[model samples]
Target: MRAEPSLPRHHLPPDRLAELVRGEGGPETLDLLLGGERSRRLLLLRMLDDATDLGPAWDLLSEAQRRAPQVVDDLLMYPQTGMWLTTALRRLRGRTPMDEPPLWVELGHMSALAAAALRAEFDFTIEVPVRHGRVPLPTLGCAVLPETEPWTRATVRAEGGRAVIEAAGAEVALPPTTGSAGPGWHPVRRLTVGARGRRLDIVLDDVDPYRTYPQPTEPRPLSGEAAAQWRRMLEQAWELLLREQPKTAEAMRRGVFSLTPTPAGERFRPRSVSAGDAFGGVEASEPDDAVQLAVTLVHEFQHTKLGGLLHLTPLLTHDSDRGKELWYAPWRNDPRPLEGLLQGIYAFVGITRFWREHRRAAPAQTAMAHFEFALWRAHVATAMEQVHRHPRLTPLGTALLDTLRDHCAQWLAEPVPEEPLALAHLCADDHVARWRAHHRRPAALRPSTGPYGHGWTGRADRPAPWRPNPRSCPTPRHAGWTAWRCSSATASAARTTTGSRSTGPRRPQPGSAER
Candidate 1:
């Protein structure tokens, strides 16, 4: 039996110590520790003396698995170290033998080594306590392990050439096997698992070796049958808009209008998840006039086509802002600012088009009901910065930019309504009041004091960060203005026949604009 080593007096934070024990320490430290021929013996002695509790030791093992699971196999080289771990597991399980092969292999080997070394010093048998519980292990199988104990049991089911395991109130199914078989192992196959819950259903797949979850399906272009219907609807909408609004029609002919499809299985409303690009192929279930859907499609398509010249790039940047790295930038140059602006413009355009097409089918009040104005405003500001950077616009580009700016300005200028809903609500009275209070500042402080910080007059006409006061205004005048503008010249005639004055200010009634 090996003699127990003296404990070190050095102190380390729990997490840091866990990292060191897991071999995540820098190379200098690891190499030094492993340099000598008797390094293994030294390590075993040190670990036995240093590990005060099983928690830290368990953490060390877990971190080793996380950093490099293969390192756990290396522990076998130190017979005493392995025995210590096995003994620890047995103690955790109250001395009950582990029922699962994987668990046994993981714990038994380590404990056996520790027990062998301690046998000379202590004659009593050690019993480990285990707490029974189940957990969902994706792709492999469900396992029932003692939460407090190391002993565990697992029953895996084979269905549809996949392995199914249930644990932690989840059902996990592994992918079908593939590739040539070796003496004891086979090539890894694609693993897929689905967890059904009372309120949610989650599906995960392993397409990459690192076990990235929720793998995306390949982008599917419109099928022949679907393509025909899509084209027909687009053409009909285009023709109708062209005949009704010649300017809008001209914009369409000049390739100012764009179309894109959202990818399959993506949610547009209620919630959104990170998957493919923000916008891609359209979904079949999407409403033809869904403002959000239209905005996403048109915005993304614009990024694909005239993005270079317009400086409206996609939002897929590879910068390490938060958790991302610089390698994710889509273009050589940072195109996020330009893409953001385009996304905002496209969102507005899509919403406008939807309103125009479905005015009769859906009320104008309901338009832009679900849009978030603050987010859109931020996008507009981003685009405006790009435009300011490149102020000189071609005749065609100037016209398009002018139109977009005018639309955005009109929305901004209109009085924000009280308790407005959707992006348009930003133009409503109550919202304008809130915007003003929130944006209030001394007049001496130029527009730079607003959210945009840079003055609007600088370079390009960027959006002012100051939101209109919602309190000063009681109702949105823009919607009324738009309605009045769209009305026929005979509006006065109708007013006269109805014996009602047409000059009174209009107020948005409660719940009149819900989407």
Candidate 2:
């Protein structure tokens, strides 16, 4: 296995990392770690070194502090406070350089943060009113770094239609514009969809667009032209949901109550994200058309449902001896863990299903939809193959895999056009080739036995059989299609004829890579 990055200097050392890992690092350590920039920076680097550009990440943090300066003290009071947002930004931008950290890394960090909160024993959440509606608030972290050098300690609460902060023998009301209650609390609009019996309030929050998560994009409310565009998009999305994906539409009706409308930097763009069950809402940007928006809705809601399921049961069993390795996900340029790969399959299953239906209703979009169905179905089937080969799943996890596998099987069995099938196979071949180049060693040179294989060493461009057997690529055997085979001679001839002046494997284009 490859060695990981070293720890940052003048900060948390190996012993300190052990302390944290062992749960021995308590309040004193938290205070010390939070008091300076070094410890916090080190913790973030450890969690995200592979995926993030450290300089750009810090630049984002500087902008975040500028936007919400009040949180600076809070950041210094908790070791992991600044990371949640910045790491989220990194993931949103697909900046992860390698595989994501294991689930425990994040779960442990959040648990530690929760444990250190002054209000944890009370088990409560603060609610602050924002012009149109009240939002749930997180417990204010320790107002003072207790038992440390003398520092200001304050508590914020809503009283008499104003937010008052009481600290160190003084009381002051915070002006609404300067300070916010905290992250995750924001003003939002309620969008009630469907009829009386099935009515659901999808809270439309434009706040994500305003946040610094994407960087360079400052926070701004939806208004004037932006607001008008949002309303139209929502209406169209709602209509498509009711028509195309009734079950997922019902999931939205039952499981989702909040919708955050993030701004699309460009027109005719669709963006949708869900931060798991902990953050109970879907954040989506305006889409080019209702069909795309409908697909985004289905994709995110699947994540919301699975996120909740994850809290109740373990999916992948923990194995201490096994190192975390990145796998090739057809949709992403970087690698993903088994868990992240599983989540991607879950979300895209619904998306593939959406395209399965839309391919018929919208003739103009049929080609694209057919292609999407073919791509996602094949990828999902491939992921199921990986899971089956690996035995690190719990009983419940095995059951969950069965359910998803069954869904993929049915989808894969659906008849697809030959053009779509060819496109999907080509994409699979490209992704596998890239993965082999990045992670695996080349096949050893061997004497050729075939008629045209004379004196040939194994080279990707030569008529060599790829490990994935790309030329004789196998689709699901039960899917009623014979394995698609391209003659090695033909493949080699094409590469030679094209003189491709290879720039290297192509990185995924924007809008082409989905979460």
Candidate 3:
């Protein structure tokens, strides 16, 4: 039998960083992993920037880089900002963030900043050798944020071992000292929330927010009220996570370092993206309330945890031939793949439970809770049913589905109010019916007597061919019912495979903002 690979007890242990490096027990795993050289605990604390004093370290690193010059390379090589960027880039790319390119970017920026700090020059540039060519440090737009302007390219002119960056009609000055916070902090904007544990970093990401999502328009910086609202909601989310979801809180404490905030009303609500993004960091918008944000956190964390586990093990066999067919997802207006459906099942399990608990804690909000509970529970059940039918599910995937079903048992059984229950039933039935209509092949029709009991002949005993009236058929977006000219059609022909009467709410149009 193959034995489990032995792990070493080192400063940066392999186990916790597995999510960071997406370790699969490969030879390069140790090299790629963040922690054997730097202490994992210290690194997390520094990123969190709450418990320990990183100011001194930042100053020392700056001084070292100034004196030795090579110290900048050493500082940049360490995977501190790399960990947060790993998560951010993965989310941006919809895949694992490439290690080398981002690392190069980090090195260039750090070296440039170091050069700026050492000299008293208002403008200086540092060039680092990249894959294509020697790219200057501190490029106009951020690596993640894409922008356009009159000046397309930026160039750096080096003279007498000193360089200057010239771009877009203005010269940039050296950034403020790295005393407490500034420049050297790079990717993360750490804040002390004055909360217990002070574990997770609530980074107000300056660089990533612009590029994190495809903005409705160009993502300008949040203004006064909007920025304050974002910060307040974020602190509240942290407190709520610590209070309600202790397990998730603990996991996030270890894994997440960055929380990129966006303005409200973005497509695809706050989600933990980048499957192997171990930074536990998720991109979210400032919600109307902290309670909603807490729920979003719980839901997305489910995806983050599952994404990490899936990367390590094969939960479902890769099916390239699955084509582009979109399956029905009640939670979303758009169709989804089996994987997206599975993600919904697991996420809604937590969302339902959140409302289940909310039903007791806040009586005034119980109605809304009951509605969400019934809505998501029914939807998750429908999704779970679809999941079982997926042929690609591996044993691990089956196990995960079983666990989700188990988690949802309590919420599924809990009674909802009649109004919300009816609504939930209507919505679920409508979605399922429409889905079947779109996918299922119609059954062959048998000859029947006409409405006036007339057959093909004048004999009443014989049957007659009939077609459905156009006015009677439902629209394509509604029930997707075929318009047939039939004079004699039985009610049974219209019934669904579930024996459900083909009567419910009509399907909402695709862009009706259903979710």
Candidate 4:
């Protein structure tokens, strides 16, 4: 009998898992999460190959693995590759319909990863597909071939030691080592924020075909002015986290790998999301200022951490999402699954923790900060009550829910200002009434065929008004909307403990808006 190859195994001790349950962990925890992702990618590749004939793409990847292992690891580690690999496998297994990119282009992604690796470390000859005159190299960037027509393949032949993209009769230069690729190559933009001795590196990923998960959009790279603005805002936002919440800031630096910039929606609202499938990625609309930007980073990063944690071990004994309507989450307009409910509670713990510090850390912004803290603290505690003792929860789930509840419990002793507390209460009551109206069936009011109080009032027959679904269009987001919009330049704010500078209440800039 032939011996099968063995795979690597990862084990997390009980204490380390406990730290993550409390919504707190250090480098070791993050490393475990990300390290697990690599193993997942390897398994995905093996399955994908067995399910379909990957052909030369598989051969290219095998060669690259043998000749340039480091480059192979680096390219596979890029987060968007995770999204692509999962979606491609789903397509192969008939879990999802074969859609627009077509199965061929999807398989071509493996070739793209292989090509990028070989380009970085070895001289290799390969042919990569060009869809609508664009060659997308997974991590590097997309090479636009204006000179070539539709549905073609670009040949990458080594000119001496360098790999160049050539299609039709023209050669497309890769993003430069020393200079810009000019207009032909739109490279993925990597931006960084540094404070004290620590730094966070993230890609503003506008070039990948698979970057969009929940809702896909066209690849729209930022204009020169817009890219510059993103750099400025990110630096300012990173500074705020480093100053007020260093530990959370460190957590972000450890995990968050990329942000896919979504177009801005209506004023007073900003949108952001992260998913369990895409562990280290976030999709967000540009916020009004640095503080709002900082909050979005925290909100998305919390989801990222939880997503990674769920991958490590099972929380529920059975599927929690066979029907999501069973669980009610205050932060969402729609009901969540038990797992989804838990995700919301974990994220709000971080958000509430941010505002709890902000109210005292920057006394000038106290009222708004107090409002956020009060609102989220109530909502999280409420959700925790529903899911904390779920019958389906394994002991791991129970531990996580209890640790989070205890953290929220500690915040109960902190007092908010009278005015903000009143406002928070009013908002909470208003949402409860609306949610009941939206979901609960009220008695149907009869026509005036009879006198008042004489008419029969059966259960209300009609459904609630339809709001925009995220699966279709951009709707006004209620979750992070309140935290991001400064709404005006006049709302001046104070500095942090170290006395560095960033935006307070941001005014709309001449050319800036979310999009």
Candidate 5:
């Protein structure tokens, strides 16, 4: 057998190498080792792979941080790992430019995710090693752990750089941090405030409470009036949202709807969001957050109440043949009731009302305005077709359908020139397209596909209609037949074409018998 070639020395297992480096025995153990850059790169990649397969690597980083805060510095200076380090730092602390010192460069390379996670756990910044040549260090402005105060008050003690928080018969251990051992206090320079209904909660980070709002002015550090103003704003926004709930609820029932509360600060932060019956959650961006939250709540709610009813219910399950087809369709196949269709129309009406009420003072119209119009047109078209095809409509059903059509027509006639152009065109186009697609399908025949080609097959022994006349029913505006009509025409044509006969009326329009 040929002698096996010697394995490359750098190909050592990552865990074993990491252990040597952590123990400060790596360089001495491997004489062939060149620089820290190569070793660090290999180590970091190993860590990353471990993180991907096991869980977030933050836990390992935290343990490393405790063992040696300088470990981060070493990794940052390590050439191969430096890029990822820089990426992580930027993600955590925001981007820092190159003109900054080498220390800043190393600091900038820190992972944002790591920082956020660590910040929640400890108060420590990695120090750059001076031996690695002149590297700049960026000063992280005053930052404090949000959980520190509560942890301290609860007689938190740290073991092996990990903190143990005991409160109300509950004991929780927290990892150790540089700050927890030092003054254990930082100034409160910023506040995160959120308001829900009448309740407003303020979180002060690295700030003195006596200086913040809800406290007497003299003892505080920052401008007391500013803090008080912020409190007032939070309260005002909360009140405004609560006051609008009734109208919001009504609007939501029509279509997708949402509500977002404003955050407490000069910059508008969204405090909370509620979306239809499906989903709603908070976001960090201040200005867009409030608007998006409100819109989501309203929009989703509309889907639940109005959109839900107009379509077929129990939405075909995955096992159903139609359900499989629905998966490929862009739109969901949730069932909707006639009442839901009306509700969607009403939602559009409500939107019009809302615009009239707030137009002059309102901010720019949101995308929701256009969305509502689209939903209204769809609901109206579906309802109209349903009414037309109901062989014998109930008195109430007929009245409702007629009323909705009249309302739609009135809306169409409105002098708001811009309003009619977009929606009317879309409605008309969609109506025609829907009819053509559905009416021409072979599966749409009334009884079944086998016996009929285009017209009805009345009975086995009896004759059926020969050719359907255009005059049999009024011409569809979009030239499409309803489901029932489509089925009838299909059966009749198929029966006549397949050698079956019909005794029904003859063709009416000139082209009725052609093709």
Candidate 6:
């Protein structure tokens, strides 16, 4: 039998939802989201069980739940567990074959979760599959076995408060669950920081296979020095957030669960990603400073909050007329769908708020903070308008946009430094010009569904950022960017209905925008 919706019905008060959409939600909001996510986890487990034999995985989980309910619940909420079950079910249903990991390895994640939970409570033995001779216990670390095959089962037995793992007839005692991995064992490390008498424990999870989103990945376990570096940076970032951005800090404490560090990138501009499938999981390149790391957490947690909201209520659906429509996203080099625009808006709202608060918090950082806040508020404001009148937007989506509209209006009214604001205007104008060359068809031409038809047929005059009187014209001038069709399709106008205005200063860069 399949599991059904467990909560009476998941809901958020409109006022609370508005607060959440505006990126302020306390434990009450997070609790509802966590419960909703729990139901989803149970539903996926039932679906996987119905589709394929979960073997002893289910029984082990039940036993673990009996022994340590909180441990079982915590492991279930691990980002990778959600990722693994979601992919496993997709594969079992014969969908996304190329995108998902192998079914055998995917199913093995169940045993991994169960082992960690059961091993936490009872001195029990179980067998979990190993990949490339390394058995990964999700939320824990990987256990590398001797004489391992490409794929084989490892027996893990925990007794007398100690554990030993064996594969291919050779056994090794597990290393203590702190510091570095032993000669043949690697354990996941934890980072803990506290403020106001409450502790925040975050898993520095570089050893889980499902740590990466959309698919399981080979563990790029951080070396000792690298791991130590991550811990130091995280502690600093946490302290920064706690001291300067308490609301965001409390939110992160309530939501963010794990950090999976990618290879280091540029000193200042590190890359990061968050997936809807993995709530509370953040993957980021190593950062150069606590500020860089703090901002990344602030930005990614926006995606996390919105991702959680989406699981409870869909904000939009495919338009019957346009099917799957794509529109211009100011932040990107290409066109995006309405959903993407919403995600960006929600994230940037949080980002904009972060910089706004940072500017006020640290006097030395005000200049850079002002520019970021200005640039993002403009992008977010325009993006909000781009989807403001979208037909397919649901009521929940509308409310979200409306909340953003109110917030952006307040931001636009606030004064910004002239130098940074001017640069922000320039960047904003450059982006629109690039978008035009890439996607606009001459307005003279009738709307087309032609292959390669995203051009304006006639004279096209677009909006420029209101540099003259920004207070009066807060909505930046954006040209009527046409709907983009990658494979020769219909052209729908997005910002077309808004009247034309003065174009910004033009700098003719060589290359055309991406088609």
368 Cα displacement, candidate 4 (Å): 0.8
Q: Which candidate is the best by lDDT?
A: 6
Q: What is the TM-score of each candidate against the true structure?
A: 0.27, 0.53, 0.58, 0.84, 0.26, 0.83
* TM match of model 6 to true structure: 0.83
Clashes of 4: 4
Highest TM-score: give the candidate number.
4
lDDT string, candidate 1, 83-187, tens digits:
333343444556735344344334432322232222122222221212144322212112233345334433334333344434334443433433222222222
Q: Rank by TM-score, descending?
A: 4, 6, 3, 2, 1, 5
**Candidate 2: Cα lDDT at 491:** 29
- Local distance difference test scores for all models: 0.31, 0.47, 0.45, 0.69, 0.31, 0.70
What candidate 3 gets wrong by more than 4 Å, as runs, is 1-125, 128-169, 177-188, 209-219, 266-279, 324-326, 434-515
Each candidate's root-mean-square deviation in Å?
Answer: 21.3, 16.4, 13.6, 6.9, 25.3, 9.7
Better by TM-score, candidate 5 or 2? 2
Q: Which lDDT tens digits does candidate 6 get at residues 215-320?
A: 5677667788998898888888788788888867876787889998887653333667788878899888787677778877887888888889899888887665
Prediction 2 global C-alpha lDDT: 0.47
Clash number for each model: 51, 4, 6, 4, 66, 17
Q: Candidate 3: lDDT of 336?
A: 62
Residue 395 error, candidate 1, Å: 14
- Please say which candidate is ahead in lDDT: 1 or 4: 4
lDDT of 5 at 202: 29
**In model 5, what is the error at residue 154, expressed in angstroms?**
22
Q: Which tens-of-lDDT digit does each residue in 1-515 have in candidate 4?
A: 98988855777777778778988776778888888888887888888888888887788778877887877887777777778888888788788885667677777877777777755565678888787888877767777776445566788765556657887777776644622555578777888779546898888888777787754343567777787788898999898888899888887787888888877755445677776677788877777778878878887788888788787787878753455335546666554566677777887788788888877887656656776788778778877876687777889889888988888888876776665666565555445444444443433474433222222232142222222111221233334322232222112222322143433442211111111
